[model samples]
Target: MAARSKVMQLFKALHRTRKEVFKGDDDALEAARQNINAEFRNNLTESSPEKITELLKFGTDVEIILRKTVIQGVHTDHNRISIKPRKEILLDNVPFNHNPTIKDT
Candidate 1:
């Protein structure tokens, strides 16, 4: 996989979680973000073999901060409801046409 492709994949995965996995709830958003982060981190192992490894690591860390921001966006919620991990579910459903090995950058 190319670095650009990996980045696009990561963004798409995160975007999917933000749109589908999370509702307008605080804990749910946080949980969704966490799941997305975890999925990105896991995929980075194969997506970005060299250069993107560090980039994805940074992305994971930044995602933690972004998750907090998302939580804050829904601070009005009182029930503190959380969404289940949907990363695997989402990934499993997405069709992949290739198993191409990413070359080291």
Candidate 2:
């Protein structure tokens, strides 16, 4: 009972992440939606508790990866592309080493 709810929750979270990560791109959204559904459907009959637990954890990891690493780009014109970046992929807020200097010993 509880495990079923957890699976559903993970499924919903993945969908939400897909929408945000693939906004303005119809193809990506459709592909990701289909893959998510198919993976879950393929394992619908698994009854082993250990395998189920591993699968759930893997799903959760995938969701996190999508949220933190995904970025979108749009081809606005013949010669230009526009990048749509979420904060998760932005490095402006992080401390970065912009330059390194070599010193003689």
Candidate 3:
């Protein structure tokens, strides 16, 4: 029972991380959701405690990497989430131009 609960907690954590990391990209979000579900489902038959622990460790590592490095758009600090603007947006000096009308030069 404890092992099952641990797995459930890990699954929830992974889903939350996925939600934060892939906020804007629908394709990446769906892919991550499918992959996470598939991996857990594939391992459902494993009965050994040692293997389950290893799997849980791997999931935690993946979550850490995804949250800390993979998705650079979202910044998380002490449970707070901040959206980071893209490099172009930060580097460009000109204000965003919605419509460019060519004036006679």
Q: What is the TM-score of each candidate against the true structure?
A: 0.33, 0.81, 0.68
lDDT: which is higher, 1 or 3?
3
Error of 2 at 23 (Å): 1.1
lDDT of 2 by residue, 64-103 (tens): 9999887787889999988888988877666667897888
Number of clashes in every candidate structure?
A: 0, 0, 0
The deviation in Å at residue 38 for candidate 3 is: 0.4
- The CA root-mean-square deviation of candidate 2, after full C-alpha superposition on the true structure, stands at 3.1
Q: After superposition on all CA atoms, how large is the RMSD of candidate 3?
A: 13.7
Q: Considering only N, C-alpha and C atoms within 3 Å, which residue pairs clash in candidate 3?
A: none
Candidate 2: lDDT over CA atoms? 0.91
Candidate 2 wrongly placed segments (more than 4 Å) = 77-80, 92-105
- Select the stronger candidate by TM-score from 1 and 3: 3
Cα lDDT, model 1, residue 77: 68
List the candidate 3 regions with Cα displacement exceeding 4 Å: 72-105
- Which regions of candidate 1 are displaced past 4 Å? 1-3, 9-13, 16-21, 47-105
How does model 3 score by TM-score?
A: 0.68
By TM-score, is 1 or 2 better?
Answer: 2
List of clashing residue pairs for candidate 2: none
The best candidate in terms of lDDT: 2
**lDDT (Cα, tens digit) per residue for candidate 1, span 50-83:** 6577776676565444444433233336966544
Q: Report residue 66 deviation for candidate 1 (angstroms).
A: 20
